[model samples]
Target: MEDRELLDQLFSGGDASASAWRAFLQKYSNLFLKIIWQFEKDRDEVMEKYVSVCSRLMGNDFAVLRKFPKELGLKSSDFPSWLVAVVRNISVDLHRHSQGRRRYPKALLRLDPIDRKIFDLYYWQGYSLEEIGHQLDLRKNGKGTDVNESFARILRMLTRYAPRERKATFPTSVPFNENMFVPDEEEPRVDVALFDKWLEGLPAEHRLVVRMRFWEDMSAVRIARILKIVPQHRVYAILQKSLQKLRTHVERNMASN
Candidate 1:
């Protein structure tokens, strides 16, 4: 069945919904297991996390499943990637729950300036590896650490941030490689009303990039295509420009106080 058709079947009530639920489980169960296993290598724990994920999906009559990006021009081809992202989130949460205690605010406060910047990029920028590589220049340092090793260490540092709400830092590209990335485990709520205030003052394109990329949690590439901005880099450019203004505004307020 087509992706949209499958969603319609699942979302609609009655016998069709039940059948679609089975089809969904049959289709994506393995994928869910794969993601869960990333957080835990033990088969028993993996199964436990997998069951937890399914329960969450089935909760409130499949509330999580209903959050499909259907309104974002979802295509059948895009379904698996979207599903993977969602599953990854659930798995990460399970992992964090096992890890015990949320200390993101404290952890963030303890980071050295350099490490803090790295966390910001990973957390807020949705930075692709290359962009982060450029910013941190992990390519080849005198230290004798390999690039992947260095980046992995940085990502390990990131596990501290605990995945509060991921403010939409729309990425410069595909963001991180999901196979290896460990995103925020959980995050405390942040009142971004101030940021939203600045957001309202942005130009149309800037506002769209910010709102779609960050607020809506849409991918940068997807936003580019949706906006029909050629070369895709234009989306990044506009986003960066918008962000600089917001940052400056925040800095100004802080300095005034």
Candidate 2:
């Protein structure tokens, strides 16, 4: 069926299980799958996100389809671009949620500036030895040490200070009005584990900016240069987004548990 016909059937408020819906998905499934694969390379991960995108599109009586501007009289050719945009957004959300479940070791927090940058670029950003070497000016046959040796040393340091699981207890006592305004008697310890958990929830670029700024103590100008971001303002914007995600996650966890 043509895109307009399928869209007309969808918005006609008729039965959703009609052939129009099936035809729509059949025609667009490949496009959506391609966009999903762009975000996730693994076969399993790609399939999972594709299924999620389908579910979302089909949910609420085809709510997403209903959002389309039918008045504009969209053509069949326009459908692919529209569908790609939708699928890409869904894939990004899925990727972010998946990343959120991971937690970096607290040992990463203690690394010195250079080692930390090497580890973050290599592991967190998935940069290769050569790429990292180029970015950090650690190119072999130059003034600096070999990238491979530096990376191995960072790995050894991480292993040496590997994080150990520990349980923490917080007071449950409720303070009255006067003491409520005052600080707790005991100093509140920073929960590196919890912080790491929140950090993982951030999008890849956002996490990179946050780590560079706070963990690596690099200026935004330096971060923009290292990350190859065009403008310094983008680094600030990413930091804002990252902090907002972390704050929201903390609030949700507090409410849930």
Candidate 3:
């Protein structure tokens, strides 16, 4: 059956359609597993959290699920993409709660949840604005969403005063890793190997540019120069496509592993 038809059936209060949704979830169960795998916690905790996120979405109103495609401007062909976005958003929230409680200096401990995440992404992850933009798939002309607005918020938070920075009590990198960069404190470890395996079947150019830019750290200018191709502003689109593929890839790999 078509997605819109299935959605119409679901939203119209067909109770038996619950199984249809269940089948949809089952079809994409790997996506949920990938989000949980990102947490990289204990196996049991991982399973529990994975199930929790799924249960939340499963019980979510059918109207809510139906709204996603429309709200995101996703096409019927883009159903999987929309599905993965929902899964990732849930996973990020789980990581936020987990990080907030980790052992830290009293000053650092006082930072708000969002601030901690921004700080983590900036200092710990070492992601540049462009890279962060690429990860979130932000683009110029406000492609779907405004890039400038999101980063402006991020910069404001990053520069926001934290008590720890004020106190000079922030631990140095070596000791900091022990305290702040704890693996379990973040999301589960992504299975890069399994993710790569899923992408092995994708088109070569798609896979190559992605591997070059992200995994190999080649800049778009460099990628264009290397590939002897004209550079366009749509590097983000290329990267976004690759990452989306990996996102789904990660989702599938997480479940299997």
Candidate 4:
């Protein structure tokens, strides 16, 4: 069935089982698993999170689906993209929660004295880049550019030197229900491995912008606010350039093959 027909059936407010909810799950479950796998490399953890996402969407008579406004200028065709954004947010939240429970590695202590100070001020002290600039006397040329550059450098160093942790196993099983609908055939899947490889090859700033704009579904204004940058247009420019680079990379690879 078309997405529009399926959506109509869902929001028709008849019996809950009358809708295409089961079909919806079967169609999109793979996509959800793909998004979760990005943050969770372990197969077991990915499966666990995938089940959790289904539970969230299925609980309370599809409360999450009901939250979307019908008049929000979203068409039925936009549903998949919108749902992907929702899954991405949930996956990111889960990743953060799990990370919080893990022990802080001693590798953090190995940071250079100055980089450590900057890291602490920004992350631990909750200071914004502009504030950190003032505290560190890095407000060169009155734009806080120096502080931003320093913070980026520190981030790169920390990411490079962070100790890798082994994947943990978790026991999780999908619940059985009569209403569960399974797809007859698998949908064509994206080459996620190739895409991830290309994404990682981009410049750090470009990669960050791409993830924020696409995966996180963040507005340029919101991204600018988080990055302490002025004007949303800068974020848009970054996204455009980054996407162009990615497209070019893909084309070159395809030609070579």
Candidate 5:
């Protein structure tokens, strides 16, 4: 069955269909990992986030998925853009809550200057935008105003930050040489140049989704969390669309070569 049909069967109270979908995901586990890698900072976090997302999303319960990835001031096109947005917000929130009791944040990487400030105020300090704006204006006359505007802009930019999220991808993506259903334990080497060229043709947002879901092995629930305010169906749709594009790309590439 197709992913959407499987989802419908599961969502409409079919336990067998849900189990079938789970098996399908497990069978194509590598593809799911690729999808997870886009947002998670490291393999450890990726595993943690994936398990968390899957636990929340599977079964007949989609309450959290429904409410999470909250729909802020977003346009229809901006919905897919919200994937990384939601994940960043979740990371920030996780960081903040950890730091409250002087505990170490779960984040593996150090935030940059701007990200640090934004993380502090928005998540750690629990300050509102208007409040942040007021404080920025006080720190330095015109500079403070700029900071305020920057803060607002960052919020807006984050809402639509697609390409910037996956700018730090590590060396991944092996070629589809062997037509096997499962991944090889050892380095099953393949053509790197062809894979790179294929990756270049993908849309940024679609590419990010593919990397996260397929390469990184992230779960849809975690994806939903990162995209904090979006509906699960929306996230699923984005992923499905990306997969379709990728499937078509692969088919054409195979045909040509």
Candidate 6:
């Protein structure tokens, strides 16, 4: 069925609604499992989280599914990106908040629940301060939760555990993983065999350009100069095509699961 037709069927409040929900579940189950697998290797844990995700979408008269305001200029082709986004959020929150708490500094542990959640969202989940500020501003009686002040206070509390360097506290300028906020778990996000499988499929030129561009951090112009290509625009074109193909290959693998 078309995207609009499927959505209409879901909200039609008619007999087909039941079947529509089932169909939706069936269609997206692979995507759901694929996303959850990024955070867990244990089959049982993955299944448990997968079930939790479906329940969250279907619960409360399907409130979460209905929350998408497709009327706000959303196109049909956007469905996959939107679905991936919402499902990714559900998976992340499930693993972070609902499944189990990661080891945190005792100082952060002593903070109240909201404070801890804020810290986790910022420190571990890598939410921007502005995002957290806006989020807290939406909550009831959350007017006092100034993100800067709270983060400053949390830093003071956690200072003892931080390294001697000044950037031990997460700074806005640095990348998320470059700091101490990286998750303790070593997530096997990809199967090396499968990864090599995709890499092996790439054309030799595309593979060489990808390695130079990413691994060596070479600019398109530099890559062109190095490879003795006449015009640099061709390098840009090749890089774009290579990335598109790589993304397509990865998504194909995910959907197959």
TM-score of each: 0.40, 0.37, 0.40, 0.39, 0.28, 0.40
Q: Please give, for residues 1-257, the per-residue lDDT of candidate 4 as tens digits.
A: 87777666776666754547777877898999999988898999999999888888767877777766554888777888888988888888788855543222233334434444565555444466787666665544554336676676644433322222312111122122222222224222234655577678888877876666554445566667888766656776676566456556665665686
Candidate 1 lDDT trough over 10 residues, lowest sum: 158-167
Across 99-174, the per-residue lDDT of candidate 1 in tens digits comes to 6542234434333334445545644444645666565544434432233544454443322122233332322332
Worst 10 residues of 6 by lDDT: 159-168
When 5 and 6 are scored with lDDT, the better candidate is 6
Residue pairs with backbone overlap in model 3: 38-187, 38-188, 39-187, 39-188, 40-188, 40-189
Evaluated at residue 87, the lDDT of candidate 3 is: 76
Any idea what lDDT model 1 has? 0.63
Specify the poorest-scoring 10-residue window by lDDT in model 5: 102-111
lDDT of 5: 0.47
For each candidate, what is the lDDT?
A: 0.63, 0.63, 0.54, 0.61, 0.47, 0.63
Mind giving the per-residue lDDT tens digits that candidate 3 earns over 118-184?
A: 3344434445556655554445344533335544543332222223333222222111222233342
Kindly indicate the candidate among 2 and 3 with the higher TM-score: 3
| RMSD, one per candidate, in order | 12.1, 17.3, 20.0, 20.2, 22.7, 22.0
lDDT per residue (tens digit) for residues 58-173 in model 2: 78988887766563776667776777777787788888854543333344544544555665555444466787777765643554556687676654433222222312222233
Model 5 lDDT tens row, 124-195: 344555665454333343332244544544333333233234332211222222221123233323335544
Record all residue pairs in model 1 with backbone atoms less than 3 Å apart, i.e. clashing: 162-186, 163-184, 163-185, 163-186, 163-187, 164-186, 164-187, 168-214
Candidate 4 backbone clash number: 0
Two-way TM-score contest, 2 vs 6, winner: 6
